[model samples]
Target: MSTAPTLIFTEALVLLGGAVVAAPIFRKLGLGTVLGYLAAGAVIGPLAHIITGAEEILPVAELGVVFLLFVIGLELKPSTLWRMRADIFGLGSAQVLLGGGLLTIAAVMFQLLDWKAAVVAGFGLSLSSTAFALQILNDRNDMNSAYGQRTFSVLLFQDLAIVPLLAMISILGNQAGSQSASLWMDIGIAIAATLAMILTGRYVLTPLFQIIARTGAREVMIAAALFVVLGSAMLMQAVGLSMAMGAFLAGVMLAESSYRHELEADIEPFRGILQALFFIAVGLSVQFNVIFDNLLLLALAVPLIMLVKGLSIYGLCRLAGSSHNDALRIAAVLPQGGEFGFVLFTTAVSAGLFSNATASLLISIVTLTMALTPVVASLANHLLKGEAREEIEEDFEGAGSDVLMIGFSRFGQIAAQILLASGRDVTIIDDSADRIRQASMFGFRIYFGDGTRLDMLRAAGIEKAKIVAVCTQKRDVTDKIVDLIAAEFPHCRLFVRSYDRVHSLSLRARNVEYELRETLESGLKFGRSAITALGVSEDTAAAIEDDIRRRDEERLQLQAVDGLRAGTHMLYNRPVQPEPLVKPKRGAEQPEDAL
Candidate 1:
């Protein structure tokens, strides 16, 4: 009885128990689950010495990040991703070049490490922890915000930078001549693998899922999804690229597929568990002895790394046209050394660019920064000048319908009710996160998105809609949506809610199929009720209401043709003696007669 099996089982139990106990407690304290997982791993491995072999568990745990990137890819269609090319390449490249350059110079000036080691360390430290940043953004429901998107762009480019960074390490070492050809070969192979994954995902994956779907075995679907992710990941790793990048590419290829939601549903549980384990594994691998030896250097290095990266990110974002607030938020959210830095530093040690002690120092610095990220991000709020709006995921599952409602404000909500009562299917989309959450409480299945975005409209299924209803609260937002639909989807019928009489006139001028001033009917009903409560008969009140509505429509038509002042005579603005406030006596002429 070696007890090896028992030990393995015990370790698994400990990891699970730690996660179960730690995640919720840290979340309750608002410290975040990332920090909690780190704390749990620290306690279990380094502090308590109950678990060992973090090195062996780490590679498997890293698949969590792979699945995380894949899920993120599923939200972004290729066309949408293409729109971000400028930020991804321009802003991202600038951050890496500038931040890496500055850090390398500082390292050399301060005699931190050999020039070669410093080079690798500088670039590695320039990269921020994608898992940490993304987790925080997801926790705050900010992944779809402009700040989050830009931050993600930089992170994406950094992931891309890993291949070249590893190549640089090989070049810097004595193995340069021997590995130079291998480096180029790796790049070529990575490109080929990426192309193969894209082709396979585009041509083979959906059909395979469709076939598996016909079998109707959910277990098989889950297995197939796992196979796809792992197989793609293995292919990329074999070619010297990242497993996460490969999974992300596969996900992007299937982003517009009908089965995307099913795949996400199947993969989500595994991603969560493994991702938590990855964070914990990182915590387990913390080298306390090295930290104790270089405590003073690390204290200076950690804050210095954060400060340099933050300033570089903030300045680059402003130069790239981000607002001061957005740039600062991006900086606050992303100043940590990434998990990729661990990989880079370990590789550097093997490549003879640095020693194990040096690598441990860098690793400790990275870990400390990651641990401090949440606290720093929270503190950033005090520095913020204005409020940042919360953003939700743009998941448009089950969205196609005959009636496409663009906004979910009060008017749209009431209109949606009538449509639902009539047994019509409606797909509603709104940009407001709070409104979407509130709507869910009342049983409305609305998607979160900006209606003015053509891609969002398309995702909400504008092509399948028979009627495009624009009921946004703001006049400008309404006009932009209306104009967008009118330009891109002329065949669809438009039914618009106008903010005022001027909006009504504008909509009519644009040849909208139907447009109504949102307040007109309610205002008329209130007047009708008031007149009926007085001396007017019900029939007279109704007739007067109808008459007023007809006159208002006439005035709107006139304004549409001529100008605002064109309908002034019809507004009942003639200077006359004031009317009595008291109800008229019975048998006196009613308001209808006066009309």
Candidate 2:
């Protein structure tokens, strides 16, 4: 059979079969679907050799990476990128340069190759798999944590850096005069094409999307999104750039558009399928025979690469202003070689710039490193846990101030400032090293510790504190802290930030006082005031705001009472009763009907 037909059939069968069989098993084991896909590729490609034509399968797999980049671009707004410039530029740049340079030096010491080859190898191995790392972090619900955000910023920068690195590699290859003036002309054309696409995407795509959106046709919207990605990718390829970069640029153009969410929703399914295939294809391409042959080399290289990358990351984090412990954790979490390394290694090998033996050795090392990242990250967490506990204890011992702040985030920072300016002896505790460093720079008395830990709270002078503000973002963390404070420091008044009605009730259940839903109350008041200012009837605006406030308070009370008894009281544990559309007569309404 022809390669094209074989590829199409294998892809469809593998995707469908893999999802049905592998997904549940992976979930049960608490591993991600990406691992499942990798396993699937191993079974189909190496074990059974069912997917016989890998060369044909690869281009299709490449699409998955392209689409993934597109989605990443969509997520990265200019403002968000700007906010993370420190992480992206400082830590990220350092990781690449230092990690790569160290690896190059190691390669030379090993007598593997000349300086140029060693440099290429170093650059290839410095990147940690953004796909794998991010997926694991997201699965563990750590994406919102300080370490997770820092890791993500570094990964984002690496993805952006790939473009320039690839360009340089191409330029160096052309310097050998393998191709004529056509090579340089091709490079210039590619640069112009990429630039033109970005300009057109920025100026024309949004309005074009707006016009398509007027049709209110979901299919057309999806088609348009696909067109932008595929069209740009084709343009990029025609001019000698990677199609992935084009798709990424197209995604960035749509980042701030009004239809961003719509485009995302439309293309998400395609992106997911393609991305899974991409990972599986990576597994398929892993030459297991070669890996087995070089088992000793693989074993040695894996740990060495990880150690080098980890040390580089540690130094970078410290330079970026993280504390010693935090720097260690960040370094430990990002020691693996990334997906891009696989791509780069394969490209260099195909171009005859890397020896078969060297390429095989590098691939084996990269794969092993990638596989071990989760275990390494978990070990890092374990090591840091002891230090974290000790720090919490010390912070609690030092506590006994007039005011205790549970979280030193943006909201807590402001609260801490006002309290301190008013001459109160304030002690702040936060889990984020980045935030703690900022606080230290500004001369705030802050301790690095989890507020949810009862011992930490006690050590933070919670018992003696006049007020304890639970100003953290996570509702679960806030609730735990409130419960602990209520149990151990009953005299201290607790003020907490509630994200919504649900969150307010969670706090209220623990008998937290001064619960403030950051948005609901403030938003209602703002809307009402705006209407009143716009010549709306004062009575109407007042009535609306009052109704919202009343409903909010009532819901909080009902949820609080229900939450207290749900675990032990059968009556409270009954399935939730729906509220009436219209308010019932006062006397006719049950106590539960108030909310």
Encode model 1's per-residue lDDT on 1-595: one tens digit a residue. 5799988899999999999999999999988999999999999998899998799999999999999988998998989889999999999999999999999999999998878888999999999898899988998999999999999899899888889999998899888889989988988888888899888999999999999999999999999999988888888888878888888888998899999999999999999999999999988988788888888888888899999999999999999999888999999999999999989999998988888888888989999999899888988878877767799977799999999998998999999999999999999998889999999999999999888899999999999999999999888888998888889998989999998876787788778999888998999999999988887898777767766776566556655555543334333333222223333334445543233
Model 2, 138-211: lDDT tens digits are 66777667777788788877865675566545545544565446566766787788779879988999999989
- Tell me the deviation in Å of residue 338 in model 1: 1.1
Model 2 worst lDDT run, 10 consecutive residues: 582-591
Per-model CA lDDT versus the true structure: 0.88, 0.75
How far in Å is the alpha carbon of 171 misplaced in model 1? 0.8
**Residue 278 deviation, candidate 2, in Å?**
1.9
Clashes of each: 0, 6
Model 1 worst lDDT window (10 residues):
575-584
lDDT (C-alpha) at residue 101 in model 1 = 92
Cα error of candidate 2 at position 482, Å: 9.0
Error of 1 at 474 (Å): 17
